[model samples]
Target: MTAELDTPILDNHLHLDPDHGRGIDAVEDFARAGGTHLLVVNKPSWMLEDVGDDEAVFRAVFETTIDAVERASEVLPGRAWPVLGVHPALISKLTGRGYTPPEARDIMQAGLDVAAEYVADGPALALKSGRPHYDVGDPIWEASNDVMKHAFELGAETGSAVQLHTESGQDFTEVAEWAEERGLPAKRVVKHYSEGRLDGPTASVLADRDELEIAAEEAEPFLMETDFIDDPDRPGAVLGPKTVPRRVEWMREEGYDDAIRTAHVETPAAVYGIDLEATL
Candidate 1:
């Protein structure tokens, strides 16, 4: 059964794939589990279909994400904000299409330029960008960093939060420096899929008991997420849609009410600059 939560319960990073996955059905699961809010991120372009040199093609991906979120808002008691951008994995796809690393990075940056317009136009509240989680050569790695920097710039320019999908086992010191230089606060730079090891950017730690406990103790001002890809083939690959509210219920049972408020209500509101309390 779902917990009767009074405060907001947010999943900071999630995707809703209508074509391949449960789509709005997943959002219903989250709401039934007592989740109140979501940061619905766009899936990688390649996941939807093969993309080429056209930067404007990303608009379809962003619009698809926004459509999912719009449908989700109809089912949710609280709210769902779309977070759009070029996924770092797109670099690999572009390079595979016979583009050099620098060319691929340019394409990714141009896509972020499109995404920034969405944020500026008030549909999206945050941008998503990060390097590949797996190992790559130095040149490709540098190109990815360049793309990340451009995203930070867009965040700063548009006054939007940025959720980064990155490799595991990082302190995010370099990312913090980049945000600082670009005028985006470290608090607004979220490290998605974090493992509670970061010291700078806001950690959107996975919704696991151990990860939450560690982030509570070590990472000040952290958030929680299921990172639910919503892909049917990989059911529960990262985590499921109901994981966040279930974990919040676990925290409530453990009497960590303050942590729940901070992670679910306060931190997200402050980072995304939204009145989440109003959603209730």
Candidate 2:
């Protein structure tokens, strides 16, 4: 079913790696369903075990995404933006498989360096760095925060927006403080897939229609995301990439036209500096 929305959507986060044959379908489907723009990211978690060589793993992840973005640019045009970075949970995932903290940090640095390259060029929209796995004991934060701080430093250096993935947005307060100390603009720091109280640039709660309304009322600068995982096997693991468009269609249906325009059009442009007018 093709969605014809009054306002086109810009999904803030989605993983569109190469092994993901489903990704092509997601791009086509999302566009067909009214997604005009996407921030395509690399999900290091999916390939962590398959590609045992840690350094090579990050390379493959970022390179595959850069290439995918290049290709999507042909079809989706300038709407396909790259989001390259190391997932904070990769360290813990590798450590569980017997890698030491230093070993993990070394591998993480390798991925982050690749991300820094694109960020410096300013083509890649943002660097995704955050605490994904939350069940670990308190001590794990020492190493995780170390990796996160480095990612944040890269953001500060490049002036690229840092889109964070957190346990439940609890770490963002501390992370935001960390970004401030390093001289990164608060307006360039974003919280990914979080609804908790965090002061920063953009925050996506993955809201439903009602929650979207509440979020709009609560914060003028808020955003929406699906966190789509483009995984072939799980089949809509978190939420489909087109979910945001569908939500926007409902917003239009419910006569929240003004709010829909703000979320799908205005906020994305103002927050990320992405000009969707070109896609039109």
Candidate 3:
């Protein structure tokens, strides 16, 4: 399919919160307007407001993730897919509230169990966690590595794609190291590109790596995203809506058609494990 067709353009990263003024319908409208495919992401804690105990909070978050996916699947059908995870800061906050790491892990497992019930066998799964700016040798970094390894294991076992949101250059290195250590399949790790001050440059660099890897290994797809958050007050917001087209042109200018196609279309389908071939 050509780029000009009203064919589906895959959206690699999207955050949806019904309570936050945008939900499935809003995302659908946006995608329909742009003629794109929408992959909706729902974080567990976004549903919780004043969760009291750590265990209770964990339960709430876990249920929210499952419920979000289940609801989205019903509401959006072929247009939407779900990604679930706990942000690192949220996990830390839960810990401060007396939730142990083991407890948190159990909660995540419970959510996965629920997810398996809803999605078909071998459904694509995405993880939403950030790498913090800290020393690689730090205990927290080690802990992050453990979490990513566990995520990879979960994806490999379920045949799900693992998507990561790394905050700093350090986070990228850490994820690469984690993937290398466990022999994580490149297809399982889909890195996101957000449109923020830090993320833009970092994403550009990552996209370059993705191109080089694709040239060398002809491996599984590496995902890219507009990752735009709309805010009337921000100058970058315009770029948010225009992200896909702009990036496509940018890639064309750079003589990176493969990267452009992957960023705007192909990688998204691969990341969500969608069968666009049949649909298009």
Whole-model Cα lDDT of every candidate shown, in order: 0.88, 0.71, 0.47
Name the top lDDT candidate.
Answer: 1
Worst 10 residues of 1 by lDDT: 48-57
Candidate 1 lDDT over residue span 1-280, tens digit each:
6757688889999998999999989999999989999999998887875573576578888888988989999999898999998889888888888999999999999999999999999799999999999999998999999999999999999999999998887678888889989999989999999886577898899988998888776637888998899888999767999999999998888877888888987898789988788886
Cα lDDT, model 2, residue 262: 72
Superposed Cα RMSD, model 2: 2.6
lDDT of 1: 0.88
After the best TM-score superposition of candidate 2, give how far the Cα of residue 163 lies from its true spot, in angstroms.
Answer: 1.0
* True-vs-predicted CA distance for residue 217, candidate 3, Å: 16
- The residue ranges of model 1 lying beyond 4 angstroms of the native Cα positions read none
Q: Write the per-residue lDDT of candidate 2 for residues 1-280, one digit (tens) a residue.
A: 5446445677788877556557677787777777777888877744622433355666666777877877766666336888888777777777887888777776776678778888787668788877655777555666677777788788878877788777664335566778778877666777777662345546766756666777656645667778877667777757886788787777666767777667667777766677676565
lDDT of 3 at 68: 50
Q: Where in model 3 is the C-alpha error above 4 Å?
A: 1-3, 44-78, 100-125, 130-137, 170-174, 180-183, 194-221, 228-242, 249-257, 269-272
